[model samples]
Target: MGMAVVTLVLAIPLLAALGLVLVPGYRTPARLNIAASAATFLASLTLFVVEPAATKWFVLDAFNIYLIALTAFVGLTTSLFSAGYIAHEIRIGKLKPLQLRFYHAMYQAFLFTMLLALSANNLGVMWVAVEGATLTTVLMVSLYRTAAGIEAAWKYFILCGVGIALALFGTILMYMAAQPVMGPGMAAMTWTELMVRMPEVNPKVLNLAFVFLLIGYGTKVGLAPLHAWLPDAHAEGPTPISAVLSGLLLNVAIYAVLRFKMLLAANGAAIAPGPLMVAMGLGSLLLAGFMLYRRRDIKRFFAYSSIEHMGIITFAFGMGGPLANFAGLLHMAMHSLTKSAIFYAVGHATQIKGTQRMDAIRGLTVSHPALGWGLLAGVVAIAGLPPFGIFMSEFLLVTSTFARQPLLALPLAAGILIAFGALVLRVQQICFGAPDGVSKAVPVAWSLLPLYAHLGLVLVAGVWIPGPLVAWFQTVAALLG
Candidate 1:
């Protein structure tokens, strides 16, 4: 039953993509897209009830089950948001009907690749899936065919392409390390098999492999120095694509890194992966915090916010204690929901106001009360304000760091404050002050349901986490260590 669920989850998107290409017109495909995504999400939810199991090609476990479910949920919600969003674009003549067909098709394809990456048991397959996701999104990022959009797409491709290549080399090294113990074959590349025999694997080879993997996968995670591709892609791409990039793709990359980190931990002789992750995480957090203050494009500003939050989650996981690991997991969930909600609101605001410029978008509350308040709530949640899940997770991370390493806590807190101040300032300017731009009201739709639902979850989780969920996180936290 579990395997069937897995197969169905993977198949829905692939089948939908094929059908979408053949289907004529926008409405049918858009509706079909949402239905397919909803089906996939339902399939993913079943994994929570099933026992952890593995096939020769895939595995289901605590670590990935929640992530898969979250990815599916977000994918479905984003598709709902896209229906209204793309319809608006088509009406305005910004996107042709043919482009809408292509967009729906690629959206399913993108979802397929991400689910494949998360579910794959073979390290090589996971890498291929991540690469496929990059390729699919590169096309989407360039969908506008504007010079700027094309440029962003090319940068995304070149940078991530190079990074994935490095990751491939690292995978080869891992296989070589495992060959001596597990013998040369598919088994040597199997994640489950590798984990069982990791202690006997060559320490030197594993250490070097980890370095490459960290740098390689870290690039995809939008860690600094390798993150040049991220902002441009987010700014240029469709809003739904931006949400997926930040919410799903980055998490998948981090999941890959965490898998490799587990391998290193299994081998006592290998160098500790924590310090490297810590350094990179801190670098991304501090860099993004400062960068946030300078963003003129609203989407780009949120893009930087994604980087900052990714850094925090990375830092928490790098800390490696049970408490820290749990915090990291919670933060990942909160950031994904909150960031995507913000992007949803931003998408509508930009369309209504006919601009992405923050300076031009003022007094949103007066202009569009629902959207303005929605954006405000999203910003507040993302900025780690109280009564939101992000704040709870961030608090856990900060306290954990202070208890374990006082010096590290200083920079962590500083980065959080820096980002917090910048986001609050920008949001206040946009939501308050004199009313400006687009006084005409846009029709409200069910699409906004996702934004509110996400915020609601964040709010509820902050105040009261269910016991079962806490237990699940604790189990995963132990596995992480």
Candidate 2:
């Protein structure tokens, strides 16, 4: 019953999204989107008071409980922002009412897909959920149907499609490995069951599975070499969608990778998943850091930053100790918060400035102080400034790496510094100048709410984490190993 509640909470938005297609009313879709998301938020809130729950189809543990809550919370807030953002787009003639309806429906579907991925007890089900999310996001990405939007969407579809197919094969391989230990049945495929019997599975197959799954999901996570599609998607998609892509989609991809990591850790004979993760993580960090220097579009610039931060989180997790895992978890949460917040500001900036080109945008601080400084704060926070959650989490990760693997720490730290330089240089150009772009007086205060709220929570967590949260993380960390 408890697990059903979690599943149902996630399902409502998706079901409503399907219902949206049948409804002819344009305004109704937006209202339905908001209501469905709000209800999911409230339903997820119930989980905080209830004990953790698990079943064959669903499970709620320390790790995913917080993730579910956070995902739902952000989903609700983003839905609210979408209401206004899409309305503005419709008003400006960029989107027709028919397209607005489609946007609302797709938004709900995306929420459902993430929730499903987070809550599924079966690994196969989780993969299906993530694949569902991929399809939904591709539609949303191409909603505008501009040549650039269509091209971006197609690219996202093809790359992610190939990646997800590999992940499915990996899942099947894991099932094959598990079947010998747990019997040739569905029980062997259950994530909870597999975790319990992990030691009994074949290490060789598990090693192969990890490689396939990592490459598959890592593409979605925007790790380097496989991240070519992300910048274009972000550059061409709606700003609200950009927020969710950076804030939620990438995290879901990482969550899938973590699941595989847990299984590898459980099988004692398998080569430690840590080294491969570390290599890929470091490679992504280094690649994104240098790539940051050449972006001409604002959204693409932050898209690269997404790759960089995802790399940092991946590296932390790859290090795999109490301190490093905790930092990785914290970094994941903080990056989700900080990146989405940056997108909120970026969305508004593009709306006011009429273009995404970095060169066309100048002196935001002179014309729009609220958005300008809000963006500045987000950039500083993401760039690892003190007093922000990102800075604290990153500090822990670096310190832990230095203590454990000093040799690897040099390149990791260098990557961060390079990324910092690129962000600061670009931000200086965007935030301070002679004020050339056309500006609007429209107050997008509501959209700013989620951005600031996330940043505030991150700051609080950095300065003083609650006792319960800390305990929860420790428990999850142990489970992770």
Candidate 3:
């Protein structure tokens, strides 16, 4: 039953992608897209109830189950938000009806690839899935067909393509490392088998493989230095695509890195993966914090925010205690919900204001109070302010860091302060002051639902984390070590 659920979850989006292409008209595909995504999310939820035994090709466990659920849920909500969003785009003539059909189809394809990447037990298969996601997103990023859009798409393809190629080599090295111990066959490449037999694998080879995997997956995670493509892609793509990129795609890439980190942990002689992650995470946090002040485009500003938060999550995981791991997990969930909500609000704001420029979008509260407040709440949550899930997670992370490594906490706190100031500063300018620019009303339907629903959850989480969630996070946190 569990495997059936898994298969169904993976198949729905793939089948929907194909069906969407043949289905005529924008409204039909849009509705079908929401239906299919909701069904997938339902199937993914079943995993939490029915524990599936590890198979030769796939595994259901503490680590991936939550991520699967999160991915599916976000996919569903984003599709809901996209329905209304795409309608606006069409009405404005920014996108044609034909392009809408293609957009809906490619959206499902992107979801399918992300699910495949998350569920695959074979390292090679997971890499292929990630690459597939990259390709599908590249198409979506270029859907506008504008020179800037095309440039962003090409840059995304070239950079991530190179990263994926390096990842492939790393996967090959992992297989070679396992071959002697597990024999030269499929079993050697299976994650379950590799985990069980990792200690016998060559540590030096595992170390080298990890390096390649980190750089490869890290590129997708939008970690600094390797994150050049991320801002442009987010800024140039459709708002819905930007939501998925920041919320789901980056999480999946981090998941891949976490999987490899586990393998390295199992190999007793290998260097600790924690330090490497910490270094990269710190770099991303500091760099993105400083960069955030320079963003004129709202989407790009939030894109940099994504990079900064990803850095914090990475830092938490790198710290490696049960508390830090738990913090990382919580932060991941919070950031996903909060950031996507921010994007949804930002999408509508940009459309209503006739621009993505932060300077042009002013006094949102006065112009469209609901959206203005929605954006305000989202920004506050994302900025790691009090009474939001982000604040809770960050608080735990900082205190945990201070307890274990007092000096390291200094830089971590510095990054947070820097990012918080930038976000608050920009948001103040956009949310307050005199009303400016166009404030035409866009139909508020299921679009705002996602924003409010996500914020409500974040608010609840800040005050109280449910027992089951805490326990699940505890289990996963133990696994990380």
Candidate 4:
């Protein structure tokens, strides 16, 4: 049953991507996409009940199991959101049916790659999976074929291409680090074996490999100085894709880094990866917060928010303690839910306003109360306001930092405040005041279900975390050290 569940989780998407290529037209493909995503998500849930069938090529444990479920859940919700989003695009001729066929295929391919990356036991296979994820997203980002879209896709390709190259060198170095101790071959490259044997591996090679790994995966995480590709990709690509990029892809990259971090933690001689990660995380947070005040495109604006939050998550994990790591895990989940919900709202708003420009998108509350208020709620939650999951996570992170590293807490607090003010200021301009452009009523209430569902979960999580889940997170945190 365990093997069956895992096979189902992977096979559904791979088969669906193939079947979708032949299943033409708007309605059927959209339904098929949702159905496939739903099946995969259901299979992912079974991972908790069924024993994970860990093998040489694949691994499932306390960590990746949670992420696999997350990836599938978000994939399902995004597909649900995509049904209406893509239909609207087709109605307006922004996308052709042919393009959507390719888009759906690539979407499944992206999911398959992400799941593969999370589940892989082998370092080389994980690298290939991550690279595959980049390729699939690049094709989708260029779906419109417009010059700007193509430019964004190419820019994404080239920048992340460099990142992947650095990562490959790092993976080789990791293998080199393990070869002498483990005596080479697949056992040396496997994550489970490496974890069992890592303390014996040389620390210098581990430190050197991590530098390349951090920057390489860090590019995908949208950490500043390496985040050029993010905003453009979000602004030019379809909104559903933007949601997954922020919600799932960034999490996947960080997941990769965390895996490597664990190996480093095992060796006493490896440089403390904490300071370098902390520096990168803080820099990204500050850069994104200030940049938010300048964005004209709504998607780009939220894209910057993603960078800011990723910084916080990275910082929390870099702090390296039980409390901080737990906070980081919570923030990653909250940010994924909140940011994706915001993109979903932004997608709807742009469709109603006939533009993505903030100036042209005023009075959303007056024009479309559901969307306007939904956007406002998402922004509040994301900005770390009270009674939402983000508030709890950020508060824990800030308090933990203050308790241990007082000076670092000040910069983190400043970054949060800077971003908070920018979000509140901007959301008011967009949601209130007089109506701006086109104000046609959204015909479907069903489309807002994912938005409400996500925000509600975030709300529930703020005040209470179930005990079993808390135990699970605590276990993962201790494992990180």
Query: Please, what are the lDDT tens digits per residue for candidate 1 over residues 1-481?
Result: 7788889999999999988899889998999999999999998999999989898889889999999999999999999999999888888899898776688899999999999999999999999999999988999999888999999999999999999999999999999999999988999899998889999989999999999999999999999989999999999998999999999999999999999999899888999999999999999999999999999999999999999999998999999989999999999998999999999999999988878999999998888888889999999999999899999999999998999999999999999999999998999999998878445638466778989999899999889999999999999999999
In model 3, the clashing pairs are none
Clashes of each: 0, 0, 0, 0
- Estimate the TM-score of every prediction: 0.99, 0.97, 0.99, 0.98
lDDT of 3 by residue, 1-481 (tens): 7777888999999999998889878988899999999999999988999775677767788888899999999999999999999889888899998776678889999999999888889898899999999989998998889999999998999899999998898899999888988898899889988999999999998989999999999999999899999999999999999999999999999999999999999988998999999989999999999999999999999999999999999999999989999999999999999999999999999999878999999998988888899999999999999999999999999999999999999999999999999999999999999988555566576578998888999999998999999999999999988
Find the candidate with the highest lDDT and give its number. Answer: 1
Question: Model 2: which residue pairs collide?
Answer: none
RMSD of each: 0.9, 1.4, 0.9, 1.1
Evaluate model 1: give its TM-score: 0.99
Q: How accurate is candidate 2 locally (lDDT)?
A: 0.87
For each candidate, what is the lDDT? Answer: 0.93, 0.87, 0.92, 0.92
> Candidate 3: worst 10 consecutive residues by lDDT?
437-446
Candidate 1 error regions (>4 Å): none
**Which regions of candidate 2 fall more than 4 Å away from where they truly are?**
none
Q: What is candidate 4's lDDT per residue for 1-481, written digit by digit as tens?
A: 7666777888999999888888778798888899999999999998987665567888887788888998999999999999999999888888888787678888898999999899888899999999999999998898889898999999999999999899999999999999999996999889988988998999999999999999999999999899999999999999999999999999999999999998898877799899989999999999999999999999999999999999999999999899999999999899999999999999999988878899899999998999889999999999999899999999999999999999999999999999999999999999999996566548379999999989998999998989999998898788887
Clash list (residue pairs), candidate 1: none
Query: Could you tell which candidate, 2 or 4, scores higher by TM-score?
Result: 4
